[model samples]
Target: MAPLSWYIALSASLFVIGLYGVLSRRNVLIVLMCLELMLSAVNINLVAFSFFLSHLGGQIFAIFVITVTAAEVAVALAIVIAYVRHKGSLKIDEISIMNG
Candidate 1:
């Protein structure tokens, strides 16, 4: 079996990449995708630890997180679509126009 450290390192790497993408990207859709990537990293950590500990708590919490993520994606995408229709582009720099 692969070691727990390997899973942790992989998760951490993905999380850092996602964090960087979210911070550095100027595209709204890309930022949202990076946010999802970060969430996926969290799920990986949760599942890995759950397996190591032989406990259901982490697994259950991961499920709740997944549910919340799905809802968030639905709502966020709706907002993004509306915003794109108004702005005519997906650049995050232009998002400030909505900061009323």
Candidate 2:
């Protein structure tokens, strides 16, 4: 079995990569994908801790996170579709739907 520290290190690395993507990317779809990567890292941590502690709470919370992430993706994709239909672009810097 892999050590808990290894899992933690892996999770941290994935989270940093995701964070970098979220901060440096201009495309909305890429940003959303990075957000999902970050959430997956969190889930990894949750499951790792749950295994080490012999409890189900962390796993349950991870499930809730997955559920929320799914819903978020659905809603965000819907918004992106609408924005593309209206403005014809997915670049974050080009979005100005609220401008008066």
Candidate 3:
């Protein structure tokens, strides 16, 4: 069996990679995917801790996070679709019409 520390390290690495993607990506879809990756990393940490600590609160929080992430993805995709319709591209730099 893997150690708890291994789980934590993996989760942290995922989070860092997600952060990097979010920061560096210029495409809206890629950015949203990176955000999802970050959320998944958080879920991983929560699940790992819940397992190690034998606590239900972490699991509950993870559920809430999943719910919120679903909502966010719905809203973000809607916005992205709208933006694409207006701008004809998903690139962040090209959709600067709202830069007021």
Candidate 4:
């Protein structure tokens, strides 16, 4: 059986990678994917802690996170589609019309 610390380390690494992707990527779709990756990392940590501590709270929170993530993805994708329709591109740097 793997230790709790190992799970935590893995989660942390995933979070860092997601952060890097968000910061370094230029495509809006890629950035959204990174955001999902970050959310999954959080879910991993929640499940790992729930397993280690034998508590239901972490699992419950993870479920809530999943619900929120779904809502966020729905709203975000709608916005992305709107932006693409208006701008004809998915690159973040190219869509600078709102920078006033």
Q: Candidate 4, residues 1-100: lDDT per residue as tens digits?
A: 9999999899999999999999999999999999999999999999999999999999999999999999999999999999898879998888788787
After superposition, the stretches of candidate 1 with alpha carbons farther than 4 Å from their true spots are 98-100
**Residue lDDT tens for model 3, 1-100:** 7889999899999999999999889998999999999999989999999999999898999999999999999999999998778768988777778687
lDDT score for residue 45 of model 2 = 100
TM-score of each: 0.93, 0.95, 0.93, 0.95
State the RMSD for candidate 1: 1.1
Candidate 4, residue 50: the lDDT equals 96
Error of 4 at 66 (Å): 0.7
* Local error of candidate 2 at residue 25 (angstroms): 1.0
Location of the lowest summed lDDT over 10 successive residues in candidate 2: 91-100
Task: Give lDDT for model 1.
Answer: 0.94
lDDT over C-alpha atoms for residue 3 of model 4: 99
Could you say which candidate leads in lDDT? Answer: 2
Q: What lDDT score is found at residue 79 in candidate 2?
A: 98
Q: Which residue pairs clash within candidate 3?
A: none
For candidate 2, lDDT tens digit of each residue in 1-100? 9999999999999999999999999999999999999999999999999999999999999999999999999999999999999889999888876885
